[model samples]
Each structure stands twice: as C-alpha cells, then as structure tokens.
Target: MTSVVTAGGVSVTMRGPVVDEAEAVLDRLVTDGVPASLMAKNAQLWGPEAVEEASRRLGWLDLPETSRPLLPELAALVERVRADGLDRVVLAGMGGSSLAPEVITRTAGAELTVLDTTDPQQVASVVADRLERTVVVVSSKSGGTIETDSHRRVFEQAFRDAGITGEDLARRFVVVTDPGSPLEKTAREAGYTVVLADPDVGGRYSALTAFGLVPSALAGVDVARLLDEAAALVPALHQPYDNPGLALGAALGASALGGRDKLVIADHGSGITGFGDWAEQLIAESTGKEGKGILPVVVEGPDAPGFAEAEDVRRVLLGARPEDSGLGVSGPLGAQFLLWEYATAVAGRVLGINPFDQPNVQESKDNTAALLRGAAEGEAPTVVAGEPALVVGAVEVHAPAELLRGATDLTGVLEAVVAAIPEHGYLAVMAYLDRFADAGAERLRPLLAQATERLRKTPAAVTFGWGPRFLHSTGQYHKGGPRNGVFLQITGESAQDVPVPGKPYTLRSLQLAQAFGDLRALRSRGRPAVRLHLRDRAAGVEQLLSALA
Candidate 1:
C-alpha cells in the first residue's frame, strides 16, 4: 500500500485490492521508467494507431509552464470585460471545452454559466437573462462543434439585437479555439478577442490550457495560482514509488483489469464542486473505447447508486481533505486536473488503450450531422426511431413491443428495462431536458439502480448523463467500451424553439436530432436502449417520479 502527495497538496492513496493491484503496476512502471518516458513525450507509449494520435496530443504535459505567457493578456481581457459591465460569463462549449471550465469556476467559487446543452429553454433562459451584462466565451477545440457554433451564432445575434452593434457586439464574445481554426479566422474578421489553444492538446486533456483557463479567469478565478499548483506536482511525478500519478493510474488500470471496470466517483463534501463531472469526461472519453475501457460513474455521494459493495465496482471518495485510504483524493483543483490527466495516461499503458483518442465519440456526431442535414434540406426529421409503445401520463415510453408486451403502467415498462441488464451490466439514464428545469430527473439514477439491485438480485451501476453532453463523454463507453449497458433516454419537447441564427435547424430540432441520433447508433450496435419522451416537461418529471416511486 502507498500514499503519495505532491508539494501542491494533491494526494492519492492505494486502498485494499487497489493497493495490491497498484503495487504490481508500479513495480513494472518503476522498472521501465515509464513516468520519465511519458514526461519526455514518448508517443510510442500506446502502440498501434494510438501511437500516431498520442504523438500529436502530448502538449498538455507542459501546459503548466507553457501557458504562463497567457496570464497577463487574460488578466487584461477579463478586466476589460468587467469594465464593460459584463460580470456574467456564459461558456459555450461541449465536452472538455464546457466541463473543464464549469468545474474550474465552481471550485474557485466563481459563477460561470455553462451552455453545453442544446435544450431550447436552457439556451433561452440564459439569453433572456441580463444580455447587457453577459459576455459569452465560445470554446471549441475543433472550432466547428455544432453546439458551440449554435451558441456562438445565437449570442452574436442576441448582442446585435440588444443594440450593442459594431465593435461592441464583437467584444461581447470571447473566442477560444485552436490556431487557424474557422472560429479564429471569424473572430479576427469580426474583431472579437480570440485565444488559440495548443493544437497538440486533446480537448479532454486541456484543463490547464485556454479552454479551461479563459472562462475561469473571466469569472474572477486566480488563474496563475492554478498553474502554480500544477507546476509543483511536476517534480513529484518523475519519482518511482513516490509518484501520485502512477499510484492513481495503477489503481484505475488494475481495478479494470480485475473486472472492476465501473469507476464510481462521489464527492463527500469535497468542496470541489462538480469535479466528478469533469473527471467523468476525461476518464470516459480517454479510455472508453477499443471495447476495453473504464466506466466512470459520477454518483452523488457515498450513498448514491452503484456505491454499494460489488465486485465490478470500485468506489472513490473525494473529500474536503485527501485521505490515505487510496479510495479517496483531495487537493487543489489545478493539481487534481494534472494528477488525473497523468494517471489516465498511465492507466492507458496499464490497459493497453490510447488515452488520447476518442474514436467512438465521432460516430454519434456524424449521425447527428446526417440527421440535421436532412432537416436542413427539407426532409421531415424524425426525432425518435419510431412511435412510442405506450404513452403513460405526459411521458411516451419508446421501446420494442416485446419489452413493453404485457406492460400497462410506467413502472412495469421501467421494470422491463431494469430486468434487461446482465449480471454486471449498467443502466445509463440519459435525459435530454433542461438540466435546470428538469433537475428532478437526477433521482432516477439511484432509483433505477436500487430497483435493479432489488429485482435483479445483482448490484448494477446506473449513471445519469445529461443528453448530448453524455454524447461526448460516456456516450463513447456506451457505443464502444461495453455492450452490457442498458440505456434509458428521456427527451422533452421544448415549449418554444430557439433558432441558431443562420443555421437551418432550431435548437429544439438539434436537441432531438442529437437524442435520436445517439439512440439509433446504440441500437445499431444491438444495445438495449429505450427512450421516454416527455411531452410536458414539468408534468412528465412528476409523473415519471411517481411511476418510479
């Protein structure tokens, strides 16, 4: 067993089976000097096609020191935005671009409104809230993500319609993307401030880069301190047994190797608000491919679903202070970012999978693009695969006739889905509704997990991922990692449609298109996935909860 902490206060401990598993992995890593090789940016770390991608994606390793030059400029830009009375910061990005900043701002006790969803009402609420005092940060590593592009377009029109035209309108937005991206060229042409991030860093590994820093800095976080904290941990990473990154990596990799692939992470008053969400993206997108990956389940706490004793599940506790139990972690958010990034990369070595590439994430996006193209070209876009099997209350339950055969109520319909999970399988509850308005949908995760455990006689992992958002994160795991997952998708018809300015499809169309696209992709792989369309958002939530109860 080992407990390690960097000078920056980020610590990792190896507990129980994790401690023994990590010992074996660390022994090999130390003998091979793998940490040193990684620090030297060796692309051959993960063999095969992964070698090519890893070669181009190691820039995140040096972001702590390399990104220092951006601070003064960020300070000036944030000051100017405040000077212009734009205290409200709205981040328009998806996956890594959105998750990183949301975690950073929240941990720093700063407010950054994240617009990662395509839900019409969610976008409308932000648009309607103090537009004069709002400055949108449009972040997209590819510079052409549909969600970010939609957000950018909507806000650009909003700024102009609010009578803030000309240079002021351009100034109302901050563009963060890679150099030479379409967004960079457009920002320059429009006179908007643009911060080009390191093209070498993969989006999920870019927390220390502009994608995470810009929004955090804009929201009044001390950006320099984050860099400093990460810097302090760099030295500790090189040592063998004393390495925190290696310890964590070994635990994650060894656990998965031991059939404990579901990584259930919970915050026990960690004061690190939403760290689990950020980690979920990094863990899932990085490793959840090649049919051999770790499934990161972000639960509410120790009591959340999937936290119970199970052979396939390894529980991690993020607390107010780092624990030596190895199943827990605590530290500064900056150090936590680097620690996990390094550990994930090392875990890739242990699992023999590329941590840098997200091969499956693109499938859903391609599906969505094809669907949206149909609607833009005048075809009636079908949001769901087919009509629902039953309409119970305000919710329409969509599944195969056999699954709902002899099922009359919502509870019986849900029981069919829960009963479908394999002995070690998981149920992913994905809701494509307003995260704020339909927040009650979160209870479904634990409820479903409990129901599965009670009925199936086997403990099952049930995860809740916001729609389209999960399309980038665990969506990879669903389509690529394991075929044992049973999906329950919840979508709603927006009360009003929000347009993406020059785009052909409205936000509602895009949202449903995304939900339907992913569902089709999952079904194409023969995965058991069910959709529950909420015709009336609020009433549907209440009715669904009642059904679950």
Candidate 2:
C-alpha cells in the first residue's frame, strides 16, 4: 500500500498505477490552491457555475468545530431517553440523512434501528419491535422526504396505539431537520425534541452536522470524539500536498478520468461497519450527474464477488490499512467522513461538475409522488406498460417485449440484461423488498455480477441497493450517470401491507410506486431495464439463485 497521508490516526493510501496517474492532476490541483480554497469554502473553486449552490452547501467544512456544542445536548437527550426506559433508537430517515448515522451507530455497536425504506415488511419489522422502549429520530434535510414522513406517521401511530399520548408520545420522537423546515415546525408544535441542522449544509455532506451526530450520540457513540477526530484532519486539509483529502480526491478524479468509473469498495476489516453504504450515497449522488460520474460498487468484502479486476474498475479498501491494491481510506469514522466530503468537493472541481446539487434525485421522488396522488384518486399506477414478459417459478419478470428479445424465462431475462451491458458497463440490481425479511436478496448482487463476467468473459460490475433507499443514492447515478448500465429491479409482495397512518397509500404501495417509478425513469431513457416482481420472496430468491447458478 502506498501511504499518501496520515492524520488523526487515519491513513490515506492506494496501490497500483491509479494514484501514479493522478499525480499530475494532484499537482495541478495543488498549484491552483484547490485544497486551501476548499477549506476556506471559496465556493468558486468548483467554477463560477457552482458558486451559487456551493456557497450554501459548504457548512460541513466547519462542522468539526462548529458542531461541538451539540454534544452536551445530544448526551442530555440520550440520558433522558434511557432514564425514561426507552433504550431503542430507530431513525426514520432516507439517504444522506440516514446513511451516516446508520454507519456510526453500527460501528459503535449501538442498537440504532434505521428506517430508510418504504418496504412494508421492513416497516413492519421495526414496528413489531417493542414500541415502549423506542424513541424514533425523524430526520430530513428538506423536511419533505416522503419515506421519513411516512415513518414518523407510522411510529407516532404505533406509540399512540400503545396508549402513549401528548407529551409522552412527543417524547418518543426526536426530530433532526433544517431550521424553519416544515418538519421542524410540526415537530415543535407536536412537542417533539427538535434539533436543527446547519441550513447551509446539504444532506450528503451533513455527516458531521446534526443530521449524523444527534442520532449517533443518542445511540451511545461518542459524538465529541467524532468531532475531535475530524478536527485533527483539519490542519492537513488546508495544505495542498500530503493531504488525506487530496490523496483521496486524486484517486477518485484520476480513476474517473482514466475511464475507471466503477469504484469497487470493500471493507477488509475497516472496524467500521457499513461505511461503504454511507460512502455509496456520498460519492454516487455527488458525482453521478451531468452524464459523467463515478459509480461506487460497494462489495461485502475482499472475498465478495465483483472484486475481480476490471479495466473500468478501481478497488478501494476501507479497512485498518491497505491490505490490497486500491485507494485505501482508513481512519476513525469521523475523520474519514470529513476526508471524503472534502475529496468529493475537490473532485467535483476536477470533473467540472457541481458536487452539491442533486438534479436527478428529485425526479424519482416526483414520480413516486405523482403515483401516490393517482393512488389516492383511485387511479391505477401505470408504472408498467403491460403484463410480464415471462414468469419463472414465483418471480415475474417485466420488460418491453422488444427488449426481452423473445426471452422465455428468468434465465433469459438475466441473459438479456447481461447482453445489454456495453464494454465497461454495469448491471444494477435494485431490491424493493424488506431489507429485514428479504435480507438474503443482497446476495444476488455478487451472484449476478460474477455471472455476467463469466457469461461474457469480460469484467463487469453489479451494484445492489434496497429500493427507495437507493432512490436517494445510486438511483441518481442510474438515471443521470453513464447510460452504459442495465437495471434489474426486484420487488416483493408484502403478505401484510403496512399502512402509512393517515396517508392515503400503504407502505407496500409506496414501495411499488418507487420501484416502478424508477423503472419508468430508466426505460424512458431507453435504458435496457426490467422489473422482477416476486410473488413469493423466499421462493423467488431461491429460484433466482438457481437460475443464476
């Protein structure tokens, strides 16, 4: 491993010629004072085009120091909750607002149940937990995330159903949102504990902000130490050379520039659980737009399938140190978070795109909203044009007849998706199933990724994300990034659909709407995409594996 920067007990390293190729670009960025400018929140470093948005999105740069004051508040809140015999912390959030906290709590070995999906089974799984011991943290940057809102409604109803009311019910919720957001307003009126995030910070970059810290601190992670860890890296970030942030940014920018846009991230003992999932959102959402982007393929580990060397793929190690070839980012989670946020901003400048803006993420949400509106109007959701192309076992595969190419079964559908992939292209498997009940579905990513490579005798990458959750992360890349990707959407029928409290639609309906909405978005772009609806999730998964094998 080539060690690039070591700061705050964190080391940035990478092996192979990827960093070597980035050396020249690193020099250019240094000569242009990109690192120092980014630290200063110059905003224009991303060019005049990004200044307006970047100006308001750079608050994360100062979060290390600025967010220190939140520690006592978070600690006090946690104390109160625990004292009240509420030991479970379930976070109701999506994407940027949820991913970081999920990682943080998990790494700390804290029991923080994250509700980041519209899957009814996933919601049901959480709701089935002991409600009397739970305090749900509802987080949303815009205060309008449908999944988060729906989660709050469900949890509130669950609490009320258990005879909790008024202040007791209010105390069961802690809301983290932007100041003056509708959520903050409603949370205050509802007597829920309200913590306002920095208004200038965007959701993805709010790792050090209240969005990430409150839930973590409440769930028993040392928030103060996270800030301190991040603070130690601040000095190095201001320097152009020997900067961990620059080293990472160079690795990312160079890989994307050298036609290696699929970043294979694996945690070979990173001690930090689920960091890649969080980074998946930050990198994919920030850079995957404007037709040029880096797609992060987060693998289970070094042993995970899809780790096979590919010309268009770059390996990234997120362990204690670099044990294999790839860009290695290892440090305390707090510092690592800051490092990546800085690098993403720097890489945005390198790639000539605005890192702060999520132009396409809203489209899928809008589509889901429209579908939900129709559902309320008693109009059938028209996400699919017609019937399934073929049904194999308990799974029904839906695709345009033209794209199916006369495929008769599930294996043919797999072949069709593989056939659609261009040189250096990828396949994305999106599951709109309960990550809890249908957890085994994740195995399909590696299985399919390896299968594609074997079938074509060429390196291919496959990415998996739970639906609606990915809708906020890689969903951006699938719709806005390189069109070289083929999509396979997997959704399951919830045996018992969970209603969204007062909302018109149920959680199962919301999940389908999100899946079909994104499917429509992909097909509209003329992307070779298909939807696999599992009439029986367990049986369908088994059948899918058999076919893939």
Candidate 1 lDDT, tens digit per residue, 427-539? Answer: 89999988998899998887887887778878788989998898878888898897788999998878898888888999988998898889889989999888898889899
TM-score of each: 0.97, 0.97
Per-residue accuracy of model 2 over 416-447 as CA lDDT, tens digit each = 78878889899998988888778888888888
Q: lDDT of candidate 2? A: 0.86
Q: C-alpha displacement of 178 in model 1, angstroms?
A: 0.1
User: What's the lDDT for all of these models?
Assistant: 0.86, 0.86
Task: Give the number of colliding residue pairs in candidate 1.
Answer: 1
